[model samples]
Target: MEKERSSLEEMLDAARKQFLEEDLTTLDFKIEELESRLAFSVTTEGGDVCAFCPTYCVA
Candidate 1:
């Protein structure tokens, strides 16, 4: 009764922690990928992304 409920709660808590850790790992990878792309975009042409646009792109 009480003992079983306590064990179940502990198991559920452990599962929740594992799920959050997996999500964090995935988010970390995605952040790294986005950061790399952003850095490349900013550096390739010159300064910012606007620097890459052609003259006609301006108003």
Candidate 2:
């Protein structure tokens, strides 16, 4: 029973790590894509507002 519990915890930890990695990958891709689209305009406040989704919303 102890071995089984340890194995389950390890699996859960692995899954959590994978989820974080995937989320970062997705965020990186979105940032790159938006930067490409905005080009030199990315630095402006208006541009920043237009380039990404709202922060308050969650999945």
Candidate 3:
């Protein structure tokens, strides 16, 4: 079990490193865009809302 867990962890770490090296710039841009949109919504709508959480929206 320990060996399997260690192998799985190593695989996950490798995959994460690969993703960071390959796609981190795109991910960062997407995150920045989302943040910008969220900021705009908060400022214009005067509320805090997330599309994923419809039940607890403050709008």
Candidate 3: worst 10 consecutive residues by lDDT?
Answer: 40-49
TM per candidate = 0.73, 0.63, 0.40
Worst 10 residues of 2 by lDDT: 50-59
Q: What does the lDDT come to for candidate 3?
A: 0.76
lDDT (Cα, 0-100) at 23 in candidate 2 = 100
What digit string (tens of lDDT, one per residue) describes model 2 on residues 1-59? 99999999999999999999999999999999887886753444342343355542232
lDDT of 3 by residue, 1-59 (tens): 99999999999999999988779788888999999887764534435456555444555
**Residue pairs with clashing backbones, model 2:** none
- Counted clashes in each candidate structure: 0, 0, 0
The Cα local distance difference test for each model comes to 0.75, 0.74, 0.76
Best first by TM-score, ranked:
1, 2, 3
Scanning candidate 1 in windows of ten residues, the lowest lDDT window is 50-59
Residue pairs with backbone atoms closer than 3 Å in model 3 (clashes): none
